[model samples]
Target: FNQNRDQITEQLFRLFDLLSITLSLLLSMWLYSTQFSQQYFIAGTLAMLCYLLISSATNIYHLQPGRDINHHSGLVIFSSILTFMILLIAASMTKTTADYSRVTITLWFFLMCLFLIAWRVSFRRIRLNWFKDKRNLKRVAIIGANDIGNQIATSIKENVSFGYQFKGFFDDRKESDERTAKNLAGSIIGSFDDVVHSARNKEIDVLYIALPMAAEQRIITLLDKLSDSAIAVHIIPNFFIYNILHARWHNIGSYQALSIYDTPFYGAGSLLKKIEDMIIAAFILLLIIIPMLLIALAIKLTSPGPVIFKQKRYGINGKELIIYKFRSMTTCDDGRAVKQAEKNDPRITPLGAFLRRTSMDELPQFVNVLQGTMSVVGPRPHAVAHNEEYRRQIGGYMLRHLVKPGITGWAQINGFRGETKELQLMKQRIKYDLDYIRNWSLMWDIKIIIQTIFKGFINKNAY
Candidate 1:
């Protein structure tokens, strides 16, 4: 079925990347007319090692179908920058920085980054053109006209670069059966017997069985029949019938297991997220310390309450934490029925109105980020009272707690911030929040942070 071609493509990409890294360095050295010495060799080796390691972490070798270059090139650039930093650190630690030529190294880094990013765009275009050849396309047939089968077909149809030419659905149901009419979007190509016949005739390359787990014996019989022919078969899991939230499959002992409710930040991802939060939060605190102090003084003078307002909010895994905000209201509300601020809420002090509108009230939550109770980017937390109110009212409301609450988030950057008085507004915000968690990546966090700096800070609906 050519399913294993992905691994082959990945290995090919790795080899190409290794050669480009080496060749880029050589090109730089030749341009500078510098002789290749032992120090340069060691430096180049270290750089290659660092880049390969970082690229693996970034999943740069996936080369999957429908990979948008704009969505991924930032990560390639990020890996390049990280590799450069590690190389610099290595040279400094070993006290060998003086041995390398700066111009050569700089040129090499730029060329390597350029080549890595450029090749992805070029390769995807080339692969798309290559897939246009009918001979290279895999003829796929699905054995069931179920929901799972339909979804798989939809995905394959949308992603043209998958290089799969779907033949049609095959089912054993009687022609007059109501299930056939209900489930089949198009007319079935033939019965299950016809599937085996097509496989034997080399007309179908890949077959996906989407029968329910209850039909184990029927599936076994079909598999036994298909085993006579050289064809690849896959089964779509029934567990997908449930709401899938970061579901993953793994081998547990001699058996397979699937985790339905899981966080994206597991193991290395957790460490990376923590490191990202710490570094960014620390750097921000340094720059905004003076402004924070000024804001605090202004809050104390303008309002009767404490400078920093505290409220309970859900953190990662539904753990309650004290969220800090500059006191932007005269009344401190943190009860079972705290109210949302409106446009002309009288409890808002004069300076508080500006703070709320500008989102300066959220500045103190940067401390929560460093304290590990929050992140620079995530699903923004709501007050405990409002959270409880919506927890039952919303379908996947609690899912947002899969990651730490953030000072600013995907919702904020997308203009989903401020008071969510209407149910639809909050639902849209929750949708974006879940989307962020589903597609969490270091580059995504960086993108959100950059966006927040430019436009997320000042929102008309924030109050």
Candidate 2:
């Protein structure tokens, strides 16, 4: 019944979007002229197709219950803009730009945007009211009494606006003190058998299985007991035991596989990241071209050996990549042991010390971003020797390589930049790096970039 409801809602959403676009087009056409034009009809149909394709790809039509109205509005505007761009491209390709009236096209685009926003706002209003009513809430239960189960209960309890009411926990373990069990946050309502009985009576609407992966037989038995009922069952996998590194689910033909360690960038996300890197790198390079040239000249004149120093560092997924920097020291250490630059290090020349303090030495890494070997924001790549040494010394240290290294990272913004002479300091830096990877988002990247611009560049700790 829930499946059918979802299917119906999805169908309605699509139909509503189609109707909105069609009505907007019709209104525009009528305002321009009473007579129907074939060119306008063709353009309208193409626009609708563009909207459908783009919206579906972006999941713009999948309206979650109690979803924020502003978020949906943003999606609507984004979809509308993409559709408009597609229409313009199609018109240009067909050389039929002059055939359709500009006023009508403009009217249609704005009207479509207005209609989409209005529809979503109205839907959100009604849905929020529905969610506000306690009687309409779905009863949810969690199986097991472990960490994951407690977390699930806490999440559900905190998100009361999601239209789910916690129905308590169902664990097989017997508690000697009923008072203690009753006082627990996810109050132990009953045993496993009682959960099966409640499901049979249609009391529970959703059941989340948070049992350990080792409890295969017990989980299977519980499934069998609830198989005859309509309660929806979900399993929350516990990957904390193995110390997951950027884990994600993948389907291999008919089998489902869980990747314990992997890069997050895939498909559209990878494309978006590449585009972001290229656009930002190109802009920044254009602005700093002369500055970089001056820095190179200073390095050559002041330092005896080279203008640019290349260091073999670990890149994405632990692959070796040559990192570029303005030679900031008298001795170029690209060997087995590379010492980190210190505040009063004698190797740093006069000009080199100034560059290092202001972070001008790392400007060449923007070129690395353009090369697709680095990101504008990510875990800063350590030298290969440092990576090898730290991986053994620190737990989950190597997971930072799951993403492309950055010029400035979350660790840098939070004062973890510069020399790490102590193992504990490296551990703290690694902790921030892993946190950045685990919580990576395009907005998060942009935020870090903005923060870097404001405060990350000039640090007293950068030699």
Candidate 3:
């Protein structure tokens, strides 16, 4: 039901945005007493095009219901700033900077920002007030009375602004006995038969069948019963029953299929991740090139081995890649029995200990990033020996390779770095890695990178 509402709201928003941009430009020109010329028309069109592009890319138009008005306004303002920046870039590239009035441009930028913020805040208030009386709310019912069903009920109850009126659960077993019915929550209203009865009577608007995949026959029967009604129905699959790694649904031609094991980096997301890795890696490499060279020299003078230690490690898709680090240990162990670096280990050179402690040894992985073998942010790669050993010990251990290995990762920043002596410690590390893959957003990656700058560099566990 929210889909239809959202579609309508989005269409209205697009029209409002276009009108706001046009009026803001005209107002700006009038305020600056500048004649509206052909140049002004060209500049206005360019600005409007940039605004639409930036807004769509940043999700400014796809405003979700029940968001904080302040946060919504901030996003609008930010999008406006980005649009202005793009317009400026376009002007510079086209060599048309002199054709536009500086005063008019400045006024238009501020005017547009003010109007955009005002429009969203006003729209939010109006929408919230209209839905506050519950007249526009949809009547919803859940079919199952299991854990996932209860969780869904609780979530809907907590988020009242979702405009859903929870009619209650419709489980057949729960309503069979008077004693069991009394112990159940007040939301467990009736049986499966009552669900069909209510839907036919138009008492329910949306029905959620929170049944497990095993109950295929029961689900199909309910589907058949509800098919005649005008009510909207949805199935909440219990994917939490398994070790789901970034599980999602996709349309393969005409058929809808779900992925039990998947990667989030697909389509435009993969390109965006690449761009992010390249830009950040290039900038960081520029900053640390001199220091990396100095560290290389120090390693050569203080150690008996190579300055750059190219060890075989498991990379994306569990492929073998040469992971580069400044050699901090006496031996290059890439064999099946490779030992993790321990506290003050004998194999660690004096300089190597310092490098590991400061995490300077991993700096050369930026080259791995540029080589496209690694990302600036992702699950940190492990040795081939470790991968083989842990793949058997830990569940979903190999899922980390779904994305490219990173120089710094979610686990490393969250105190799961260094030697994992206990199997539980390694399990916890893999949990964080899989979690990263599950919720891999550009903002999350940026947050991890910022956190790494402060806390990830000097971990006590990295001996």
Candidate 4:
């Protein structure tokens, strides 16, 4: 019975996805034919593929059916924009832009986006109605009435789209403790062994083994017994142990399976980010070359030092790297016990003062982005002395190096850009860095880049 239910759910989900894709394609075609040319068909196809890839990466499609559509709609929009921009840029670069009509392309984009949003909303409504009818729901039973199991039951009950009929739980503990077993209520069907019997008898379609991780022996024993039954068994791992940020599993070579404690940009995500960085960096370099040359010449004429300053800083994985910036200070300190620039530092040159306040001195790091040592967006790299000073004081400070340091980051834009004179300020910056890692998305990177254009460049703390 469990197997049959799994097959049905799988089929239904596939059908829904197919219908969504079909509707999106039709909308694209209609918009293209009416306004844009046939060339946009290629754009539409590529956009769809990008959406699917990014959606999978972000787990948008894995959301249970009854979940709120509004909560995930923002993610969908972000993914769609990233995909659309990439395709649009690709089309322009290939010199095949004439293949599609501009009107068609515009109309197609607007219509397709609307279609995706509408379809998801409609799908959720239909699934909710089906679940309320109880005609296509699965009878689900919990193995333990512990905190985790109770929480799971509560979530299932609240999320009607999960389509789980709570048939109750099976625990050996006596029901005398009213506080612990209050939520479990009358859902306690039988003992652990009785769950197996009910599953074997095709009474329950799903079995959630929510026993604590410490009960390894009992869990193993139960799994061994469950092997003979046909019920779908799912074990809920204790995720409270580690601060997991987008945790996943991957295989090394053929047989080596390892769980990831950090993000994986080394795969497709890495490739996409790198491509974005290179393109943006190249454009920036071209635009700033003349201005950068003027600044270099001014520094050479006005100050007795090199036009560019190289400072020792912590790079990706906490490794030391030389960060290049337009020389802003008369005295360069790359050693231990470095002091941050104050309101009126005698070391800052006249031109350097203006550049630092305006953030023009950091323009040379676009070259670093091209050099593969930095990203267009990430936690801003700190001086080596600063890294040493803070790592001892800050918890999870080194985790920021999990990815390459960026020209601008979430912390910088939110007023944590420079001079961590206070310990709490550094802690706040590290928190933002971890948040970026926790919710790293291409759309987020783009959003940060956009925000930086308007607000990140000119900050009072920059000097």
Best by TM-score: 1
List the candidates ranked by lDDT, beginning with the highest. Answer: 1, 3, 2, 4
Q: Give the TM-score of candidate 1.
A: 0.70
- Expressed as tens digits, the lDDT of each residue in 1-463 for candidate 3 is 6688878878788778888888999999999898998878887787778777766655666755555565455556666776788878888998988988899999998888888778877866676677677779889989888777877777776665677878889887755555333433346778888988999999989999888889899889889989999999988866465445346887999998777668889999999999999999999999999999999888888767689888898888888999889899898788688888899799999999999999999999998999999999999888888899999998889999999999889899879998889999999899899888887888678657755765788988998
Over 4 Å off, model 4: 1-60, 63-67, 79-87, 90-99, 177-187, 239-463
Off by over 4 Å in 1: 1-4, 172-187, 240-280, 283-312, 316-364, 375-403, 406-463
The lDDT values for all models are 0.84, 0.82, 0.83, 0.78
Candidate 2 residue lDDT tens string, 41-140: 8877888888888777656666465445655666677778878998899889999998888888898889999998898778767876887787899999
Model 1 lDDT per residue over 12-40, tens place = 88888888889999999999998999988
Clashes of 1: 0
Which residue runs does candidate 3 get wrong by more than 4 Å? 1-5, 66-78, 175-186, 240-276, 283-368, 371-373, 376-397, 405-463
How many pairs of residues collide in each model? 0, 0, 0, 4
Candidate 2 at 56: error in angstroms? 1.4
How big is the positional error of residue 446 in model 3, measured in Å on the Cα after superposition?
A: 11
Q: Sort the predicted structures by TM-score, highest score first.
A: 1, 3, 2, 4
Tens-place lDDT digits, model 4, residues 1-463: 6467766765564455445554665676674565444555566567767777776555565545544465456555666677778877898899886676666556555665676677678877887888887758898888888888888888888788888888888888756655455656346788987877898899988889888778889999999998888878888876443343246556777765444447547789999999999999999999989998999999999999898899888898888888899999988888788889987889998999999988899999998999999999999998888889889998778988999999999888778986667898889899899778767888778767755775778888877
